[model samples]
Target: MTFPQNEVRFEQLSTASPSVIYSIEEYPGRPARFDYLSPAFEEIYEIPVAKAMENAAIAFDTFHPDDLSGYQQAVIRSAKTMQPLQHEWRIITPSGKIKWVQANSRPERRQEGVLVWHGVMLDITDRKQTEAALRESEATKKQILKAIPDLIFWMSADGICLDSMPSNDAFQLFPDSGRVGKNLYTVLPPDLAEMRRQAVEKALQTGDVQVYEQRIMLHGGFYYEEVRVVGVGDDRVLVIVRNITSRKQAEIALQESEERFRSAFQDAPIGMALIGLDDRWLKVNPVLCNMFEYSEAELLTTRMFTMVHPEDRSILQQYIEQYLGQSQTKDKKATQVELRYQCKGGQIIWVRLNLSVVRDAQRHPSYYVAQIQDITQEHAVNRMKDEFISIVSHELRTPLTAIQGFLGLLNTGIYTNNPEKTQRMLKLAMDNGDRLVRLVNDILDLERLSSGKVQLAMTTCNASELMQQAVDSIHSIADQAAVTLAVVPTKAQVWAASDSIIQTLTNLLSNAIKFSPPQTTVTLSVQTQTDSVLFQVRDRGRGIPADKLESIFGRFQQVDVSDSRQKGGTGLGLAICQSIVQQHGGNIWVESTLGEGSTFYFTLPTPDP
Candidate 1:
């Protein structure tokens, strides 16, 4: 017989409801039984209604034997005492299926002494599945916490430790043990625990997450933590702790790097600054401040154009606008633009400016980076050099005019007693005069090169032919110095200015012959490579001093000043050679051993096919 199932029906009538109903009745000499089962129970137990009503024992037999006594106690207590029984038990159905059932039964005390049990079975499988998922998630969280190299704790709203996962013990990274189910204050110092409590309390009060940084004294050192506390529920909170001592150290390193940048910007040998849009001063370092004779505050108030000389301001502005526009289109290059800028002290400083553009995230112009160098000294030196060249030119011209006049008169037999003697005297005068003119021309050429006044016409030519021509031009000097001169070429073609390369070779060969001991050899050689060509002049002479080798190619710079006295020649030969080589996009340097020999080496670019 079945018990009434109206209350169960009312409780589970909704479509989303998961509760199932069943009716149980106990009869005399007949086992207690279910009279009816709801539709959901069929699916829950995988049982058929007809078989369960036919034999009640079919369901009871498959219960786990260990739990049978508990189930029996619950049913018997409900029958004898007329109380409700609430218990969970496993049942096997005729379909050979096992299920968990939570049964609540009530016994009606009546004259017949029959017991009736009525209850609903909720398909709590999904609930059990949710519980299992929660358990797994908690276990995974604990595993992750334990795997971390840092200490972690979860504190309740009242500052109680609900749970904690301490790190591994290999290094005893987390010193605390016995962490769970204790008050937070019990485990920490009063001050640190109070700080954490306040942070959590603040998060609770505001209902917003809070993050804080804290330092704790640990095993012989301090540990820095970046803590984030969030309210998980009305009465609970979650805390995440990350050890940030290394990150703090890294921040300190970054600070040091910024200090270096600031120092370099302020005290650089060259004038440097950060200029923003609209010509405003974003920053002016010490060098730049001094260059403009303005304090940082003053520079911030003044526009960048204020420092430009009046005569050059228009051109400077035009270039600035052009650069800003072009910088918007592509990668900004460090550009060199020479202009005149007036100092606050009214001095017009000749400056060579190298500027770079810094852009914003959207690729818009942000600011300008300027590197300015004062070139007044170089300009003055160039002027002095020009004057020296003019003086030399005048001296050579006077002598050449007199020599030509005397030679012409002697050839006409004017006031000449011995024609052959006059002719020899005139020839000797002509030779010395030509030497003087050559010396003056060399000095002038050097002056022009040093001042960047000479223009080059560059091209690719035969290296062998150039070397041969250089050898021919210097053969007379080699013979005069009693030195053997030779030309050797490893490659046929090289790229360079023909006239400049010849001049360079002539200077090298002349220096070799002038410095060589009698009967020594002077060799000119050319070596070619994939990208460039190397030309060398080697002389067995008193080689350059080791310390003075670098300056030997500078204008008026010589290895031995007394060499000029003995040689009676201008000291601009090597310097001119160096300038010419550089203009051809090459380099010139010397390698030598004292008293053994000196080799002057120059390189020119290889011909591009």
Candidate 2:
């Protein structure tokens, strides 16, 4: 067929559009006919156009049976209203392929009981499938959000709440406002609103996820939240809020407790140090630094064992070696030990040290905490008291034993027949009696001085006269021991209690005479100075051992126990002398060479004239 050029172009456009144009007549007993059918008929329904044009009833056969009724009803309604007919329906092609189609046209009533409709139809199969998939995805996302129990919100760039999903009542900060068409500033607090606005802007700008935390108070309890914002298209964001109130509360409580413990460790009155499993000091307090005479930095740099006294290191070393062998429990604590520690100045002081292990989160031993207290003076006093008890028991038994024996012999009439024999026995008994009296007197004198029951009578006296009187008092005892007393003449005058000075000197002379070898000279020398007088009593006796030099001044302590028993020397004389010298504001000490001799020196302060 021949056609004009414009008509040919229009025909090409229809063929390329892949649509069919149709006309319908609703006249009585008249059948509908397709006035035009594009080439798409064969491509879509698997039928040629000429066949569809011959009879419209043939194309109706391809309409899905389930959709045919709805399609017919929509067309009839549109025809009655004389409105544009728009409808969608499913069709099964002759090749058994299901396809979706849309019809768009206007219906016109030509006469009574007669209607003419013209429309174009196109395949919408891909669009319908895409829409169904989108619906399904949206449903899945909703289900997931519900399951997580999170507060999800969609907000615009201007901080307007577009949509939201509600959570539990306890966590719902804005109950009524989590809806569409609400501004964030109107619903939330001023601070939070501004923060969320800034977060929204940042998320939109960077196209990256933004996270933050905020605290809110509700119902007199603090609440914590975590907010995450992610940008969607068109300057909108999706914000997810999670309530972390419980977790935050736990963290705060833990931090506060840790801080308190840290403060206590730094400021405790007793010495404290934190040592690690490797026996290194991690930290030390001021008291510990003062006690050991080390600076904080020095202690931290030094090892714990280096500062322990050599004699007291064994037990501490044993613990360090067996640390790993102890119980693997975080709650287990180590026992305490009393030991000596060396100061920076090389002096040793007694301390009670307690150790406890600190653990990490994995229950592994991380470090150790050591608490120490100085007990040097207390321990010395306790030792002295124990020695006093032992000596007092022995001294009392000796006197009681002699008195019992003499009384028993007298009652038995053992010396009854001979008067001279009785008199000799009586004399021997009297000698022991006198010795007992002397021992008791020494005990009382030591007790009085130690307990501060005796006051010193301060007076000025000549040091030479004091030495002379002491020598004279011990003259007979020196002769009995075959020892000679040699006094170094000193013209020094001193302020002191004459009686107390005389007593101290006499005690020193008696000890020298008792321990002296035969024909040895016991020399008494007085070194006078401006502030004090130093007196020395030197004896050529079996000398004291090095270790007992300090302890000999303690009650009942002797370098050799045999010395206390053999020389008829009660251990109380030296203790009494020490007390007397100390009460007079003086110092006393002893120096000895192993086999040469011993010297006792004491200093008495001289009052200013």
Candidate 3:
């Protein structure tokens, strides 16, 4: 009954074990009997240790209904072979609760027909629950990987692509470049592959995640990737590459926009500057710097007031004060001021300055953008316009006075006393009326030509025919003037408006005849060139001065005031001819020497064959 020291230790350890030590003896009359059961039966199986020892049926009742057959078969097989039995199965406790237990035992057959099994049952329910949770977490991780659009790769330390997620794989930068088991260097450019290799090495060496951006050309377009590399294990790294092409393109576009603004600022035809609230130059463009003959560095250091002329300085100061006193706003009309600025050469120049307030994100006024345009020539043109109006009014009133006087005499009974006097008065009135009509017509034609409103009926006409028609039309007038009419015949064809060309020729021929001495020749001629035809009217008359030759083509211009009145010249003939010929893609000019003959020339383009 007494045991050795080591044997007693083993018995004490087995009794204290967190498992139940059990034995079942098999017989032919019944299934089995529990000859021995450990004290763990009460706490683990919710059964009294003594009651389970009363019959092996207590242990049999604990077997889960579904696992009962497997448990029975395992016990039978182990008993037949007298081998160790190991099985994990479910057990139903006395309290109607299910417990997962692992039954490990050995089987032995003693004397005839007496088969016994001694087993140890340990509660394994917690382990089973933990395993189930692990499996579920792994499944969830796989789903997340599938749902994400980021391209992920498992790359070996040597830069080979070991695996990729999202099995379609076409979203990869090198889709058709043979992915799995292929080295990245084989598909990517040498520099990019080296960059990726460096990223992997960094992750592995530092044991920290590495993030970088890469620009690549793929699928016939530019692509940008924000790549993150993390070491998963010794031989592989996880790479998550997200497409950032849109963000990259936005950055590029912003840079280009900034560059364009800078270019416009530097190359603008008018001066532009950024001025601080204190009326100091913050930034001045090249044009502004050039206008003041100051370098950019110097201008930024100088105050805007210093550049204004002495008399204009007060005006600028008042406006600046007014602008500063007003509330800062947006969508408000810019204020424009005309002022004078003295240049480096000591000359005062007039400038029209327009200023707008620039705002910050919070809508507070940041600075003022000023555009300055030189208006010296514009002011001079205004003065000339005033003088031109006065001269026109005088000219018009003179003709009006003559017409009114003659018509008044005829309208009243003053001329009714005699038919001869009445007829003569009627003729004088008609002459004045005709001159007024001619003046009005000339003004309207000049206005229409200047406004670009006239639509010319362009066609190809024989130059010889145009000249002969002008001659025939002016023949009687030519006879009255006693100027001989002649023509230098030409067969060249030209592209022009028929009516406009004929009118230009007739005007030139009439002017020629009117200016020529009686018995002198007024010649109409056409000369053919490689690409166009030249029409000329030459007259043997007191020629124009060299200076007047050019001015005679101006609207209402006259070579001689006395001559214009004597020859009934409108002075608009040459200007009309110039406009018509120039509209046909040609040029017109007059060449003359004082006291000699004059030749007026105009060219018309030839039509394509």
Top candidate (TM-score): 2
TM-scores of all models? 0.49, 0.61, 0.58
Kindly list the per-residue Cα lDDT of model 2 for residues 1-609, writing each as its tens digit.
Answer: 456987898788877887866666666577766666778777777888888788777888999999999988997798779999999999999889999999888887776777877878888999999999999999898888777645788999998888877654456555634367888888779999899999999999999999999999888988998999999996799988888888899999989989989889888999998898788899999999999899999889888888788877898877655664675643556778889888989989999888878888888889988999988898998886786676687777776676677667777986788788667667767766766787888888888888897778888788999999999988998998899999999888778888888998998898888888999999999997769999999999889999999989977787777786577777778888899889888899999997899999999888677
Q: How do the residues 152-267 of candidate 1 rate in per-residue lDDT, one tens digit apiece? A: 56778998877665555443335556767778788778987888899889988888888888787877887677878888777777776777888887887899999999888987
TM-score of 3: 0.58
Per-residue lDDT value at 167 in model 3: 49
Alpha-carbon lDDT of model 3: 0.83
Candidate 3 colliding pairs, count: 1
Question: Per-residue CA lDDT of candidate 3, range 1-609, in tens?
Answer: 456987788668777988988887887677688867777767788988888778667777888889999987887788778889999889888778888999888877778788778888889999998998999999999888877667887999999998888543455554433577889888679998899999999999988999999989877888998889999988789988877788899999999999999989888999999999788999889888877788899889988888898899888877765765674543457778999898777778889998878888887778889999888789788877786576567656767887788778778877677999878776777776777777778777776876789988888899888888888999999999888999887889999888888888999888888878899999888888999898888998888888787888876678776665677766677888888888889999999866788999988999998
On lDDT, who's better, 1 or 3?
Answer: 3
What is the full ranking by TM-score, best candidate first?
2, 3, 1
- The TM-score obtained by model 1 is 0.49
Q: By lDDT, is 1 or 2 better?
A: 2
> Predicted candidate 1: what Cα RMSD to the true structure?
19.7
In candidate 1, stretches whose alpha carbon ends up further than 4 angstroms from where it belongs are 1-100, 105-150, 155-162, 166-210, 216-223, 228-239, 313-333, 360-365, 408-609
